[model samples]
Target: MADGKNWRRAGYVGAGAAGLLAGNLALVTGSIVRAAGRTPAAVDDGPDPLLIDPPQLMRSTVAPTGDGTLLHVETSLDLDEHPSDTVLVLVHGWTCSTRFWNPQVNQLAQHWPVIAYDHRGHGLSEMGEKKVSVAMLGQDLEAVLTSTLPAGKRAVLVGHSMGGMAIMSWAAQFGANMADRVAAVVLTSTTARDVVQQQLLTPPTLPRYTEMVKPLVARAFVAAPVPLPSNELTSRLTHYMALGRHARAAHVEFTDELISRGSPRSRAAWGAAMYRLDVAAGLHALSVPTSVVVGSDDLLTPPLHADYMAQVLDHNGVLRDYVTYGGAGHMVPIERSEPYNVLLDDVLKAA
Candidate 1:
């Protein structure tokens, strides 16, 4: 009788404790969900970048860059119902290729035609002269769009990092002409003005020593036209920065292969242009509905930078929706693919 009574007492205490714990968890989760709203963290370790499930129409070809250079480009068609009146053209960042957009291609293509191409010297594209500029990249995009999709059809332009700057450059040069055709713009982990000046004005993510190395790398790339050690070195070093953990081994391997494919000329050109890039005018002039996505933990382009962009647009009477994801670093497209695709769809649907 005594043992039975004690057992019942112990069970009651355990149940009470469990209930309290559960209640606390519920409270915290609710707080998080409320604060974060629609944007949620991506919590999965899935297929590696290289092994990204293939899209329905994966086409590859070399297109004219309008510079007399045959630049390589790739496009992925939707596997599901294709929505006309919209095509999503993805522009990748520094040292990254069209494959970087793989995670979102199929998902976004479901609603629209998704096309991405390697910048002149990145991915499968032809190598060009060193000392690249955002203007040059913008020209490449124009050539690709005019030759392949052109401006006649309505399109949504999505760009990340250097790709973002390239699109802005295109807009700056082309202005309302391009804006009329472009229904929306998605800028991720990128900047609108002189990055060097901005970095100096704000909290520095990469060490000052790292900035010092930029000019050196650019010169070496332009002069020698040989792939620099820094490209591979940085790739190996920052492989795990995208997500909190090292991406699946396949992701690392695929990223390595893609970056390795970039020509020294392209790399150097991009580096030089990056140092001098300033698209504040373009960003302010963008009349299309815009979405700016950044990772809360992004060191390269921190949340503050995204905030600045929003402020810029707001002041210009151009309102842009900003989505900041927690626990994600610079490589957002690959690390948090689903969230990106979902948000992009929402933006597209609204457009």
Candidate 2:
């Protein structure tokens, strides 16, 4: 009789605990959804404006993967002034196109050759395969390097977000010859793994409920509707997720435009892959001079990722530099263009 009573008591306690956890999880999810619908706080008019006018550049089409996926490549080379031995290749992040690098391109193209391209299923590029993975993105990048860059020329690769992940994937698969053709690498606002587990969607105070909430967060990304409505809610949500608290309305609009242009199917496909991403080995495989940049306020790919990446690269005999932007978010390149441009110039000159 005593044993039976103890067992009943334990069962009741467990059920109560489970109910509490479930209620908390529901609250968190509801909060996120409501936050997405709320209007974003307005910002004062600021002098920080985007560099909208880009220089006229040559356009070319290349089949990087040889899998019938044609990548749209743009280059601005003042062949009269600079040598063709080295070039700067810019890679944009997820849901973004070559246009994301316009500021950098406009600033750097005057001194050196600047090349930018849209990833598969982004911008002008056609979706090549039914299935998408980081490995496939790496293969596409390799194809771009092989076809667009001259035989003996080298490049300083600059990648952001998914673009950065693609670079890591490239290093993992093509690390053997990377040192020869790649002069330096810049990985901005990216990660090597644990993206889903360490995501900031759920509050850290709820450590006990993190595992339970992760799947819900991941599903939200994978199931997000395409051509997101152009409303105050959508604007607020984009600003919240991609930019820092100090972002202007104009900046938020620009980011929302790029994000909304992305294909819904492609977005979901890539989101699924990112949820399960683990490329720590790829970071170690990077043998060239590398710079890792992240915004301190970045919620998606936190600063811990940059710290871990720097640690791994240093351990593997690779000269690495880690930079953090205090008030910036995941969109470091756009949010802090002045510092970012200066950093890129320094890296390119060093390369």
- Which candidate leads the pack in lDDT? 2
- What lDDT is reached at residue 105 by model 2? 72
TM-score of 1: 0.73
lDDT of 2 by residue, 254-319 (tens): 788888888887777787777778877788888899999999888778898888888888777775
lDDT of 2 at 112: 78
lDDT for model 1, on a 0 to 1 scale? Answer: 0.67
lDDT for 305 (candidate 2): 85
Can you list the residue pairs that collide in candidate 1?
Answer: 131-269, 132-269, 145-150
Using TM-score as the measure, the top candidate is 2
Residue 118 accuracy (lDDT) in model 1:
84
**Clashing pairs in model 2, backbone N/Cα/C closer than 3 A:** none
**C-alpha lDDT (0 to 100) for residue 292 of candidate 2:** 91
